[model samples]
Target: MSRRLFSCFGKASSNPNHDDKATTTADLTTEEQRRCGPVVVELFSSQGCATSSEAELLFSRLGRGDFKLDVPLILLAYHVDYWDYMGWKDPFGSSQWTVRQKAYVEALNLDTMFTPQIVVQGRAQCMGNETEEILSCVASAPRVPAPTFQATFQKPTPESLQVSFTGALRTKVDQEGVSVMVALYECGLVTNCPNGVNKDKVLANDYVVRRLEKICSVKDISAKKTLSGTVNFPLWESFNPAKCGIAVFVENSSRQIFGSQNFQLPDNI
Candidate 1:
């Protein structure tokens, strides 16, 4: 089995159950990017897993320096709960995330599931927290050739905010089964690890996945074309209003990332 999602860019298979599905995102105007902020790094992690703990620590330390550069990289940590059965339950784990991870495993044929996985630009994946490996991955990572996409949060009503994106598809990059996914997240989360494998450790999680809207394709991602769209964020009853934010990424059938960005829900949003 190939550990790849789509051999082509944004051209997912029509078969929904065939492990590859094509997607079309809603349309938007071209002016949205200027209002949206920086590039985001989404980390799939877990506290019950010791490996993720180290990755989280190392990433946190890196944020202090690597992010000081002009390109400004944002780090978001999502805690996967599948490992909760191993003597300690990760209070932050969501069944939805477990399902998401399983889908990636099935699509990519990972053979086994593991924590501390990092998806960069929805184009590649690597074991997280490994300084040497991560450095190499970044140094050799391909440039995101697609048109730039940007998003911002707008307060629509008291209970919901609108997430809008702007960009163009200069050309179809993925010949395989790559698609884009938009998500909402919460930032600056701290948990007390009283009983998990990370017991006695205080963990700070960033970019925690909150709501996933849909899989998308660049509207007109051709060389000089441009497009945009919006996703409404309904208030979830269980979510912490204070910690909620948003994350967006372009991913392939294998769950590798192509491009991604995230933002915090405005104080008023």
Candidate 2:
């Protein structure tokens, strides 16, 4: 799919269900207990980059709920295709993801693009291996608005799953140009590399993005202004429902993230 955002610069581009369940807070981490607002961490990485392993592991820990932080953390791992030219081609790599990263490069005005890069809440970018810097960015991220965000999941048939998200814009940005996006992410993935810089290494990954869908664009939004959309996904034979989840976030024309929310898929279904 093309990685274009309708209201901004470009255009871009599920489901199986045996169960129907309206998600609840219990299906998600307890955000009410968190001391800070939601923080979205995007990792642009490649299996061919040796340094990406460390960052991937760190993201795995966060996804596993090992962090002691007081904020809600939403992690996403976007495997870029740039490194595939190496001996080993990353099975998860996508040129669309590479385009997404390049868009960020222009948005953030960075010196150059590199593997194992981390963008925190779309406000700061740092070397993915810089653990201390990553933590500081999360610690200082702006607080998102309260429980105004909502996500609902349902399986109307055995072959499809439908997800609907609703949330309000808690903050405003310049030009009043903003867009909402919903992403389906999978966790607890492992890949064994036979060739490339990471040859012979078994890498564990989480919050690995499987798909990203744009919801809508807002020319202007005031506090509590609602943004909502529903997306349908086909259930693939390779999908492990228990290891999946959803993430939703708002970004401005400049690609700065305003806030985000996430929820885990219930095992009962």
Candidate 3:
């Protein structure tokens, strides 16, 4: 929305801080949740990167709709493990996310992957801190058709959280080529860097991905078709449903996201 954007980090970086996780202000109206989400913003970040904090801060604004953009976004931050060797390890970093970022690198023909980068709707890519470019991507990105979802939660054991969801796809896509991705992301997180480029800094992260799973392979029937599946999220010592939410999206083998929606767990089910 402004030409005031900055250049991207080309395999090089700097440092900054982060944003608060989901807040009471992030809650949307029923109609907004019911409609097909406008975009899916995937942030590939790390606590080890100096510039990642700026990106995280920007994501927090987008997540909170601070700019009041018309686009509805489902945000997920994947803290990658590549930077751990620098000094400090991101408590949330994982090789799985590194692999995911690598796949995006290949799909988008990027020379290399870096922290504070974002993929919009699995179709557009940009530096995470490039606020203006991000907004541009959101305004022009292709979106998925509207979807419907009903979710239920069950605590079978203290260590496990079972989440079952039933939903209907409003559009058709190849069943074998795509799958539904369910991510359990948490907010209200704060970490103090012990070392690394971000040493001695306080970082606040929002929408940090805690668990990701392929709930089911997608199939589009000619008629109104319903799909249901369950994802058992391993409960951590500090797991709290209030600050966590489930984001479901359809992605093909090519890493193109078709549509996505986020749901807050109901108090009863």
Candidate 4:
């Protein structure tokens, strides 16, 4: 029995042309299905904001094999550009994401906007700076039937890598206003504080939202939708393996998060 899921739209304001429906890729043999997995956790943050630093710290602490299951918490740090005028332009900031945040504000019916907002499961939002709240949210979170998402990371030479993911819809969903988003993040970013809030304190950040790319939308899921895309990373700077991983998730017909996951590829093929 096939159920219909209404399509949802993204909160971003630029209104980038999106498919909003299912897409197709080369046929995947049965073997391809074995390695896919869990939902994702997204954090909307900014580099120049002090509050966001706290949240980044929390994510760093949690990603340290502290959770019950070895299940790594998949995270995508969406660098927002609204706070750039405050001084210190975030190398990773994107104005388009700021537009998306506005849409979320309207959707959540909030009084105002702020930094360090954590979007969990695409249905809920919490302040990233609150450790207790984040812990509670993750502990009691609902379990979703694992979806099929395959990602491949390749380093053709050195100092550069390419990551790709293909997400398949598990249940039939009404493709009315939803969009499929493929987000990219960097791990193990350390900075010698100079001008920001934590001056002189060398801060470490993991699960950082370095970049965001909206691949398509739920409107494309009309019995023929598949989520797939790729993002490239440059390794010119120093990074840590323990603190690095790739994350991806899907938003529903109303721009609410529906699913997500994080992955750190194994070293030996």
Better of 3 and 4 by lDDT: 3
| Candidate 4 lDDT (Cα, 0 to 1) | 0.58
RMSD of each: 9.2, 10.2, 8.5, 10.2
Using TM-score as the measure, the top candidate is 3
Stretches of model 3 off by over 4 angstroms after superposition: 1-8, 11-35
lDDT of 4 by residue, 94-162 (tens): 877777766666666654566777655554566777766666555434334344678887876577667
Q: Rate the local accuracy (lDDT) of all candidates.
A: 0.58, 0.71, 0.77, 0.58
Ranking by TM-score: 3, 2, 4, 1
Worst 10 residues of 3 by lDDT: 14-23
Lowest lDDT block of 10, candidate 2: 9-18
Across residues 182-230, which tens digit of lDDT does each residue of candidate 3 receive? 8999998999887888888899999999999988985546325888899
User: Which prediction has more favorable lDDT, 1 or 3?
Assistant: 3
Scored by lDDT, the top model is 3
RMSD of 4: 10.2
Model 1 residue 189 CA deviation in Å: 1.2
Candidate 3 similarity to native, TM-score: 0.85
Candidate 2: Cα lDDT at 139: 66
